[model samples]
Target: MTGIKSIILAGGSGTRLWPLSREMYPKQFLKFGNTSLFQETVLRCLEVSDISEIFVVTNEVQKFFVIGQIKEMGHSIPPENVLIEPEGKNTLPAIFFGMTEIEKKFGNSVVGIFSSDHVLDLTAMETISAAESLASDFLVTFGIVPVFPHTGYGYIKTSEACGPGYRVSEFREKPDFETAEKYIKEGCLWNSGMFLFETGLFFEEVQKYAPSIFTSFENGGDINEIYANVEKVSIDYGIMEKSDRVAVVILEQKWSDLGNFAAIYDEFEKDSVGNVVYECDPLLLNSDGNLVYSKCGKIVSLIDVKDMVIVDTSDALLICPKSSSQKVKEIVTELKDRGDERAYMGQTVYRPWGSYTLLEVSPEHKIKNITVLPDHKLSLQLHYHRSEHWVIVKGMACVEVNGQQFFLRPGESTFIRAGERHRLSNPGKVPLEIIEVQLGELVDEADIVRFDDVYGRN
Candidate 1:
């Protein structure tokens, strides 16, 4: 446990738990009880061993969410350890990047790769430690004891037990209902897709099993180049399913991948009427087995719907049946095809400094409520197409315009002219809230000309 390093793969964008989890912010950054799934995974990694190091791999859009949650979790991991992937090449590349860094810093330590969106029973994970410790010459993979015939997950067949772990006999792809039911009866384990490995062994297997990925690393794991050549293959296809040196550790743990509406509906507490309501004021007249979430703390009423999801956010409202929840991604794809921001972002867009919620937007103007954390500063930027007027309403805000700096108190207002290099900073300890109004002939967010950004935006 002393030399164990953890790599939490936090780069999932297709997770369809929308309204709460979108393409920009997936389930990894979502708060379950108080802590997010990613934060809980990091904490669990700590408990598994005295984690020597931790690395999180995610894209730029998700970077702000990851950074904010990690900061809020109050871990000892340094800022430099958060690896930002310029572009995503699926799980294999992300895990390989972390493995590459671990090999650089601490050589040949046992590394555990955990998916940030899983709910695992910690007690069984303790058994995983023992299994990994005793595993010989194999990539140790944790397989959940299948409680039901799930066709969504792959299955692992093990022939013989080899000490604490079993040698993986074969890997089965997602099967039909009958095939899934037969696999469960034939003692096949649900491929948990979680793996633990000795760093050296894992890399050796990667070289032998996935030469494409290994060769991609030859160019210093340049993510853009990796994405250019690499096929859209998951780690299962890239390594585990093909690698001969693979072993399975059976985990009799309560685990679930909250990936879809059905899985989410199964996890919540339901009432006598069979409805899972997250909102306090949700009036469910006859809704049975429905999952409703109100992101803006507004009351929602489900009159006569059955087996549906009613998720109301400040910017979007999704009302669909459980059977149609999977089609929500199609809607997202259509939105992206139409170049709509609704596909990737919410009204409250997160930034490195803080967040800005779009209160209104029009052809010639837009209004936003910007919140800046203490000591946080916006970019030294200028809008070529619009002038912005800022009014502070919460805390003291320090503003800069045309080389002139001034402190603004609550109830005070200032205007930044177009093409003027200006910046905003929160000087107070509390959050600085400002009402920002933009005006121009053709105001557009794309006209921003940032001279400098601390968060490394171009």
Candidate 2:
């Protein structure tokens, strides 16, 4: 594992788990307990690689989540290792970007590409480490031994035995129930979407199979320009399915992608009545085989409900049968077609500085409970159409209005007229809390005009 590095893909919108997962805040950032799926993936990567050796590929919106969550774990990755894509061009480009970056600094090493949102037992890392020897010549993928006929995942058919794995004979798409059963009977393994690639061999395959994508990255232009030109394709479609040097390492450890609510229900611990309850204690009279998740911590009661998926967030509630959970992405599409912001964001949005919770909103006025982390500051910005009044509820605040700086204690207040540049900072050791009320004809996030930002926003 000396020359090995890890690449974590963290840019998926995760629409299937929506109402809990949003475009800006996806399932990888959601906490299952104290740790999120993204953090769990990072910890798993740490078993074989050091923090500095782990590279995370994410987009602009999720860059902070990647940095913030790593900080929460009492560790930090190299700032450059957190590669931010100008725009997502799917897994092929993302993985290529990570491989290119690793080659630049560390030079043609063995890289493990992993998904940010997956559940896996730690024993899987040992198998991953053992696959490095085969990775030198083959594009190695971990194939989970199918426990049942799972139609949700693609199947990998192995032809013959190779070094610590088998030669990949065929890659099957996600099949129908009957086809999935047939494949399982024929000893096909689930395609795990995780790969161990030697940089030299991976680049060679990419150059041969996906020459357009290879040329775009090989030209060495700006990342934004490169992403703009490259086609949107997955690694499976671009390279793995076309390459002849593919190998499948059978992973015997427990694994789940948790692609939908049904998959989540399968992973969670169920009650005696086969009900999975999260975040709140629920009263159920005759609820069997139901997954109830309430982030609002409200009392939920279900009577005679069976095999239902109930997700209650601060902004939306989703109720669908467990069998129909795969259709949740259709609901997200409808919301997007209707131009609903709820499809992209939740009531509570995370920022680089901290987080803000939307308390109330209307045509003329909007209110938010804003929390700034200790020693953090908001950008020096102004609103052309909105006037804001901020009242500090906790900690110390350093307020700057049009370059005149002043300090405000708890219970103190300040006002900024429309078009006046202002900024807020938390100078105390504790988090600064404030209630911000905006008055304007246009009360939206698009109204802000940032003059200077430390986090590099335009």
Clashes of each: 0, 0
Off by over 4 Å in 1: 49-52, 134-136, 219-227
Tens-place lDDT digits, model 2, residues 1-458: 45579999999999999989999999999998899999999999999999999999999999999999999899988999999999888999999999999999898799999999999998899989999999988999999999888888999999999989999999999999999999999999999999999999999999999999999988878999898898889999999999999999999989999999999999999989899999987999978999999979799999999999999988899999999999999999999999999999999999999999999999999999999999999999999999999999999999999999999988999999999999999988999999999999999999999999999989
The residue-by-residue lDDT of candidate 1 on 1-458, one tens digit each, is 44567888888865377666777777787775788788878777876655348777777778777777777777556665678877777888788888888888877777788898888766765776776664438888888888888877899999888878789889999998899999999999999878888878877878887888888786654557666776555788888888887888888878887767777788888999888888558877867888888868677777778998888888788888887676777777777899987777788777889889999999999999999999899999998789999999999999999899999999999999888999999988999999999999867768888899998899
TM-score of each: 0.94, 0.98
The prediction achieving the highest lDDT against the true structure is 2
| Candidate 1 least-lDDT 10 residues | 127-136
- Candidate 2's C-alpha runs over 4 A off are none
